[model samples]
Target chain A: MSQLKTKHLLGIKNLDREDIELIFQTAANFKEVINRPIKKVPSLRDVTVANVFFENSTRTKLSFELAEKRLSADVINFSASGSSVKKGETLLDTVNNILAMKVDMVVMRHSSPGAPHFLAKHIDANIINAGDGTHEHPTQALLDSFSIQETCGQVEGKKVVIVGDILHSRVALSNIFALQTLGAEVMVCGPATLLPKHIRELGVKVETDIKKALEWCDVANILRIQLERQQMKYFPSLREYSNYFGVNKQLLDSLKKEITIMHPGPINRGVEITSDVADSDHSIILQQVENGVAIRMAVLYLLAGVT
Target chain B: MQKRLLFDSPLLKVTISRLCQQLIEVHGDFSQSVIIGMQPRGIYLAERIKEELESLVAKDIHLGYLDTTFHRDDFRRRDEPITPSQTKIPFLIENKNVILVDDVLFTGRTVRAALDAMNTFGRPAKVELLVLIDRLYSRHIPVEANYVGRKVNTIQSQKVLVELDEKQKEDHIWLITKEE
Candidate 1:
């Protein structure tokens, strides 16, 4: 059997180019189901998936929930807010209790990084890291890869500049790894304090000016300026972050017509991205969200096959 | 559970080999001809046929499985449908002869629906239906098996079933009367 048969999807770096290619090929085979009216498969009918969400989300949770349903698997949602997890239920206790339920897979989105690794090491079922703290969100990266593949004929040799708070964005970290794997040269541009200390080692050039980053890139992925990053002493204020590193209409003008825009959702609207640029034709943020269901469907189908 | 016999016994090796030789002889040099199996038994039939053809030639043959459950008009009423098997037709089937393989030919509704579902994948040059047992009873749809293994003239009350060993315990065929 292929390594994919028993693999736990924890991050983008865990997958090689061959694995990504296999996933793309598998996703291509499933292209028909998405176009069909029924939009379901028997591949995962007998399987059960548990969506353990500890964060507030509409798009991510719904996409994952719909992905499980689309793959014909029984889906169960668990939120720490309403569940016993709110009352001092440890992560291990929660996972162990769910493990007792005999679920085949756990698609988890936790605010703490390395929690998925902890779960996969302990649980028998396969674990998929949806979004873990400000560390890595593998599925978002995959969907972004799918979206990039759709817009550009291929990701190879394309200059993709990711702009905004890099130190506190999991989507930024994941997207950088994914874009580079698909053969894109990535450039991260943001304020000095918001950027990583060792940004160059992360496989991309770092630019302080957003306009310069736009001029040197074909695709611009402007990350959300997570309001929570304000409390971390990364930057002085959101207004300063917006004024220095925000992707406004002026910087959007700096981008050539061929340059595209991408963002891993819940945009700050006027913070990291202005209202005009967020609603601009270059924005593939909504497309990324729509593709989330389809991409997650593909992941569930493949991972559930292994399960 | 109700386990009804569909066909007499597993098809003899000689019979399957002969069928393979015949397919090779009819469709000479299996390049453009593709076999699409209608699950869950047609898949095995297609595999056996492809193995025979591969022994005769040295080319990469594309094989696909199409589950006709969702295509049936009685889709919602079928309790719960399984996720259809992967259809691995990497190349578009614009001008290829799509030989659809199935195990039993009863009401012909399955083949009729299979054809309807195949159109969504791509337009094939031609479509030919193959069946292990061609039961000439309950012809609700105008589907005729072009390639038939056995044509049993049975009453509508009787039933025929086929089982393959690829993913099952035993390979056999049996016939039985309706339980009701």
Candidate 2:
């Protein structure tokens, strides 16, 4: 029996080295289980999980749902589009009502930063922060780290460079913390405006040169240029962004060593990464998606396993 | 920890030889069979048995490993997360005699979980349990090993420890009693 010190998986910052290691080790098991002929496990048969997405999602929602189903958990999905939240219902009220239905766990993806954290303090049921604003997507970081380790052998002593949208990307924040905790030398590379003001405070080297970063890194977790979250034009145009920070095959091949490419997708293909580079053997984007389910399964399994 | 000596090295070698002879008599070259060891400690015992069997029968046997962490009934009710091990049942068990090997058989919960785990890799024609030591009267699910090395009477608080020559310096068995 391996117990996590924290009750809720709110952020990567809240988790220690052992917590991350345990999650990865557990995810390794689930990864094996998912690859089997019969993918489903009877670990969470009696447990019920509620996925409360206050924002729109394609991958995270489906990945969490698949993970819940594979664990044999009773899944009740509550998207804001069809929920009481659209009817001016309070976050607490809606979640409390769901808890009244005997849901044992809540997997939430909110648009507001600290939304899941606030809910975790109030809710009796365990909360897994799917993606909360520009805060932290712990599971995404976990899966990304897991995928990196799976590909490059280990995260320790490896150079991991996160390219594009560091300021607005929750994945960047989480990945930086996770990779650093696992002893990976982490770097943030993007346009100066897209990078956070206090980005260096996160203990990651800030690299504006994509080629330099890519050349140094063993794994490059490229983030999609967030067009939706932009309030104003941070950069001149999409074309300019692509010209400057975009990862393409030509630039990758010029490097001495082949680096593993990753993207938390809905990729602006030509903008951050080209289609050819994304589909190349060096790219592990699909593996990241596959590892996402395993990582989420590990989180749900461990959290639910707690008596 | 207080330890009482049970079967020692010489007795262990004889018992293992006897077990292999019995398996040879029953399985007969083991063409339609696969041996799966319940991990993590069971693997050592399974390897030793496979070694003994191969030397006696003059043929290689299919050996697999199973981890029952995810298939356990007490999964969600446990105090902490159950760390699962490698479950490498490479060959299909469909319509084959599957031998579930373990170091010890006590409450039978592990064997029950192994059965559940085995169901994923297609249905076997038949399944049998083989244990190095079977503690009598401790059965929780009425599981009886077809091939057992030794049968011992144990109290509720007592524990059985089987150390193989592959890992330990010497092959030995110990019945451990807790301090008051």
Candidate 3:
């Protein structure tokens, strides 16, 4: 009967330390499951899950689908473009229609900040927020911490610096909440305009200089520049943002200690990070992607209670 | 809180030693064999048996651990979520004799899940079951252990508790009757 306290994984801020540990520990088991010769389990065979993406995604959608399929669940994929939502139907109507088909879980990514949270309140099925606007991407944070735990042995007592656009990146907020809850010291490094207001209130320090931030941390989770979310130019241009906070090999090699690098992907190469740094040994980007499936599987499996 | 002691440490130790001797007689130096303990509680018995076998035969045996939390048949139908245990199998069991160890064999559903979970690693040459206690007539599946420490018959409302030295002050077996 040991399970997560929360019914819905809306945000990392809603979870405590033990919940995060429970997730990471469960993910360790799923990681072993995926590494086996036959990488499928009949855990959710009797259950059905729907991936409802109101926002466009590449990695997140594919990762959720693969995770659900690997768990042997009946999966239904719905994209916003061709779905009833694009035909002037409300969010609730579209979701209720999906629910009427007897879906046990819904994994959603939306352009609104509290879309999943709102849907969770009105719906009976389990809700997992894949990414909710610029508010939170809980699974990315979970997988990031999971991958860091796999690399550094543990997350507690380690220094993690999230670099780049904080205001427009949901990944940064979730990572901050997750890392801080797990007892890791977190710092945000980026341009002042790109940073969120009152971010220091989150119990993390702000370092505008990327070099100093990289030098003082055990891991740097470099966020990609969310160009689609940018309405006006946050900084002067992409060139200025790259000059200020972009992580490249030369900048990484200049540091005194070697740190693990991570990025929640769909990377804008040569802008937020160079190709060499993304593909370097210091980077765990691909591992993050691989761990994404295990983490999502753990989330879905935990939510789908055991008999 | 009502409990009845079935076996104490001295008797349990003797029974485990007997099981180890039986394993050695069947598996012989255990070079072409592997021992996989069901995770959580069964690991304690598996470790104890491994230690006894090594001491009796003066040879090391390959040991592995398997967790069947995610492979259960009734996972989605349960009222509460089930937390998973770690699965660690460092060596491949392909074409090798495999011994699946557990503390008690009750419904035999766990053994069935273990069999399903083992397919991911590789096909074993053969698989045998070992348990400290066998609950008579309680098996939902037709699983019978190759080596058994003891067998007992119980009603539907009773539960068997196996306390190991790893988690308790001493090793003992208990049968508890739930109060109405």
Candidate 4:
């Protein structure tokens, strides 16, 4: 008897081709269900899923809430704006209280990377890492893989460059690992201030040179810089960052017309990338957002053991 | 784009009919046996098989309904279903050949979930599978059905649709040529 089940999806590194396929299959079913007259399943009726957003999130938190509700799971959202986390309550204390309420699962997003993992050890409820600092957004990576598989056909042998804020983007870390695992040539490029020193340990080539990275890739996944978290005196200026690393029209023209551009939004337009580049025909960023729902639906169902 | 059927000249319906004959011979022992279809298309194929088997078998066999929406691998990515349809098995599947049925074999997640779904009901003596079309594509899991209706090699992006009059009011197998 193999211990092959998805009670918790903490990271993308834990997933294999089998796990990815399971997620894709689960999303495909829900995709069909949403097209019907009635889009709901009684599979998880009365099950409570606590959404702990210790940090700010728009698309991801709603996606998880929508996913949970679709499977008939009751959802309770806890955002930092009006939560005890801002009151300096310990993360463990808050989580333990949620556990005390007997929540079935905890879909958490925190400013710290290890937040979800920390909750996983402390709570009996399933812990799904919504987004944890700059560490890794596993589900985002998984959904991006699903979108790539759905649209681009395969992940293997595709030249995929992740441009912009590599230092503060969790999606970049997770996507790079997943893409390379599926046999894609991975490249990372950004301003020296935003890009990390060494990602080569993960077998990815780091390039401060943006034009060359774009030219050598089939897909360019743009990363958004965290505006609120940008410390003073780290980088020269936002305008300076935009001129060098931001994917403006001039930079976009360097790539082949067929090449696809992606961004894990809410994009800091004119800062890390231009508005035209983010909304161009080459951009699959919107597709990624749409597929986010389907992919997350797949993730929740798989982890919940729906089938 | 010139539309053409890449499969062998033999019709899919005829292939499914022949596969039915083979299944009747192999699992002819109707005792403790059940055929649960993986909805929404597999149910139609199973219904047809049930009709065919009723005429041949001496004993009345058990026909079960399975909607795998609840048993899917990705529940977080899509809109939720309001009432996940019931999984009704009239008779016990103890020490029986539980032949799971489906339309297409793509990434093997459906089959994977089916295996997981089976355990929730009861432990079966044996689990066999009969697929209408085996679209040879990327498979993440090592899963194969006991019986196959047709084997059509296709690209990863091809849309494989198995329509039934019961649901779509259209009965045919069609592949979508993806627009790049």
Question: TM-score winner among the candidates?
Answer: 2
Q: What are the per-residue Cα lDDT tens digits for candidate 4 across B1-180?
A: 323353332465466568767877887766667899876667777887776677667567788876765656555444432234445565677678898988788889878877766665667899998987787756888887789877877788777765466543346677766677
Residue-level lDDT for A285 in candidate 1: 86
Model 3: per-residue lDDT, tens digit, A63-112? 99999999999999999997677679999999999999999999999999
lDDT of 4: 0.75
Give the residue spans of candidate 4 off by over 4 A. A1-6, B1-67, B71-180
lDDT of 1 at A234: 74
Each prediction's Cα lDDT score? Answer: 0.77, 0.91, 0.90, 0.75
In CAPRI terms, model 1 is classed as incorrect
DockQ of each: 0.08, 0.79, 0.67, 0.06
| Lowest lDDT 10-residue stretch of candidate 1 chain A | A1-10
Cα deviation at B148, candidate 3, in Å, is: 1.3
Residue A92 in model 4: lDDT: 92
Candidate 3 structure lDDT: 0.90
Best by DockQ: 2
| Candidate 2 backbone collisions, by pair | none
Model 2 DockQ reads 0.79
Q: What is residue B18's positional error in candidate 3, in angstroms?
A: 2.4
